[model samples]
Target: MFGIKKFFSKEDPQQTEIIKLLNSYRSAIFPIGVQNEWISSIEKCKSQYRILITLPFAAHSQQKQLEQYLLKNKIKEVAIAIETSIPASYKFKEIKHIVLIASGKGGVGKSTTAVNLALALEQEGAKVGLLDADIYGPSIPSLLGLVDEQPTAKDDKTLNPMQKYGLNTMSIGYLVPAENATVWRGPMASQALNQLLNETDWGELDYLIVDMPPGTGDIQLTMTQKLPASGAVIVTTPQDLALADAQKGIAMFAQVNLPIIGLIENMSYFNCQHCGEKNALFGADGGSELAARHGVPLLAEIPLDIQIREESEKGENLIAQGIKVAEHYVYCAQLLSSMLHLQSAEASSVEITFSDD
Candidate 1:
């Protein structure tokens, strides 16, 4: 209100007979393209102001995604203000029995154990999905003969999972081109993993087996934090070098508070192909010794066999082929099931379905 100027400027000039026109209108409504119109009209104002609008209702997860997008773009304010809460996407719920196959050192057949254990679970009849989260060296695609395949599109923005040996499978390599290697930093690798988990349609599953890379690195940290991991299985050969790394793996998971389901001594001993007698090529009882020190179960001692490597490398489903090798995986899987309290019927459903159905 201008005080001095208004008091002095009122003069004698006056005009009579003025009419005021006013109209009352109802609440405004618009068509489908209303947002486009609003955006277009906003440019005409040029001035800036802030106001808040309320959304009628929204799913908590969807609201969070919207908030994240706004923050990502550094949006200071919007019409709608929300207390967004996004629910995390997980492969399974009440998963009670997640088995992670990991190693501290490389080239120790951790992948082999992971693949075989998943098949063993499948054979046992649990709805199982395998996640090849080994960003450094994902061998599941090659080992399972899924190297050339890709996941199918389930929806416009979602992907259907691939199946191999009766296990729902998702792998980093499956999403990328074959010739291209996913050589990315930690954040990028995490994004890839997030896509694999959130975008893929992995329906109800009994167990989700994760094949972790061999190391106590960022990837390992990300997994232990992000995944609702039930337990882990440490695989190693019987040797000081492998055992040393195996100890690191055990410790890393322990540090993250994940339970060690058991220890598997792969290539523990060599049963002479000709003599049929056990030979301690690496050392004796290294895994058992380690397990004892760590206070865990020594689940299995898989002897070093040419057949095992050959079968894995050649894309053969060795668990399906009954042998000393297959039985070792079966027994290890059973031990894990018992420790994790996995269901017997769910665990043995594969055998039942194949035989009965």
Candidate 2:
């Protein structure tokens, strides 16, 4: 069997150069903390070398760039394998990362972004889950076309997550009637969210996206402080009011010491289908400005497209339908996952201890 150690031991200059090149190559999309040990193994097969690399998150989008980079270096007959794994941490063992999708207020398409981003991550070859934490207004059931479906009990204490589009999902809407409004107080809503989160039998997942109810209120604070979330992604529009609320959301996360992964600006603009011109319906670059001000990456700027609204209304996934705008969601998922991986890497380097003085 061929291995990195043995390949280096053989003293083959060509093989050594290949390994050196791979170690030195940095993915443009990957965060700064990426290490060279990502190259898991290397083997010679039929005059071509097959290289297997492991990462903390799925990055299918960077495969082509990596291949092109290697090709440019005259490493023509090289095969690449990209695999992802959960980082070692005290965070949920079963779930690698719990990402909160939040907004300052409702109507910024937070739920839609959550659902589509979950699907996009799955599309990028990661095991993903979606948990609709919106107790007052759960839209994931409607968004995933599972409004009428209920999750089955795995045992007396746990309920199996409903599966759709290859995603493990659970929502409050699945347990309660869709039309009935949840008239519970903040603590009660927070308790229900806790129950839904703890009682669901979500199998090992690369990412579990929680579509949080709009705002930076009690429920949001409860989730941030309690859950072992890896990070958060704030969703907003280009409008001033939404941007203001987004700042509040960012501030709230900072107060709780939770990492803000990035921001997604939905309904950023509209494109005239007939004239092929772009229009800033809400406002121009508000999301970008907000992200820049907060020192967070602007993950994506989703346009105000009729197709997105219509498909979401019909409980359809744009990525499933191969819509053009689906690319934006995929890009967001890729960048978000990369950020989470980087954040985890950073966390793993730090050491914390507790002592009763």
Candidate 3:
């Protein structure tokens, strides 16, 4: 809890008004008096006030809204700090949330999206880790330019995650030769995934983004049941065939009672560099329609850009470089964090009390 008295007088009229406004704001719930840790400081100089706040989750949109509200109320300046909070987890106590990135079928650029999303979240000031859960065809190592790298053992029991671009990462690709075939049974593959997830020493992560294997199959079901995931982000192209498969993925998570964070439509369109015209190569609005029908947010409609492909092949971090398409990835990451916080808050709101007389 934060000490309000240190920053402002209890009887100050302006302070009181500001507190009321923050608590009443629906998008960014402050509850300053109770969960006062959200607020770092409040200072006043003449008629102007400067406020500093710290949020548990990334809420850039809400922060913008808050700034607008304060300015409208004649406040001179406002700053809201964002940080990652360790929400309760069913397992892996060090991790706050486990998010699986899945798709209905392959070739939709799910792995590439997962890599960029993880990097985007890190850019938003969260401690993030990436796990390549695609057993048979692990691509994270190659995607991150870590194909030759290997993870070291922290102890006899656990292995330290390989660090690249500030992300602690793990994948079977690190252990096996890329040229060799992973010929194994379903149970064997599942066991390998379990070991990779449980045995890695992911020290205190805000999010562990698992790049799940494409499709709704045995491995997918095994992970959905075994891991206490916060939710899943379904990645698909804006096409009828891809959308149909995406629906099946959604249904699988729903049947297991796992939440769907949202949907991401990759390869949504192509913007001609020469003409500056937007081309719907695959199709348009398929992702939005699917999301609307399922009551899930359409997180992003990533444009079909050649640079995105080129960079992925070279294992480069576009967000770090501040590329044009990086904005879309960052927006998706911000929304993902904000939606997770909203969902958690909504779930915690429901309480049942029992009385025995």
In the order shown, the candidates' Cα RMSDs to the true structure are 24.9, 5.1, 4.7
In terms of lDDT, which candidate is stronger, 1 or 2? 2
lDDT of 3 by residue, 46-156 (tens): 656666666666543355667777678765555654444545543466888899999999999999999999999888778899999888789999899997889999999
Model 1 residue pairs with clashes: 53-79, 124-347, 124-348, 124-349, 125-346, 125-347, 125-349, 125-350, 127-206
What is the C-alpha lDDT profile of model 1 across 30-131, one tens digit per residue? 101111111111111132212221211111112233334434444433222322111122335534345688888998999999998888867754567888
Rank the candidate models, highest lDDT first.
2, 3, 1
TM-score-better candidate, 2 vs 3: 2
Q: Which residue runs does candidate 2 get wrong by more than 4 Å?
A: 1-9, 12-14, 350-357
TM for every model, in the order presented, reads 0.68, 0.90, 0.87
* lDDT (C-alpha) at residue 278 in model 1: 89
Arrange candidates by TM-score, descending. 2, 3, 1
Candidate 1 global CA lDDT score = 0.66
Candidate with the greatest lDDT versus the true structure: 2
Cα lDDT tens digits for candidate 2, 1-357 = 234464445655556667667656654356442344566767778878787777767676566766777789998887787887656453675887899999999999999999999999998878999999888999999999887898999999999999989999999899987555478778878888889989999988888899998999877888778778988999999889999999999999999989999999999888898997999988898998999998999999999888888888888778878779998998888888887876776677632212111
Q: Model 3 has how many clashing residue pairs?
A: 0
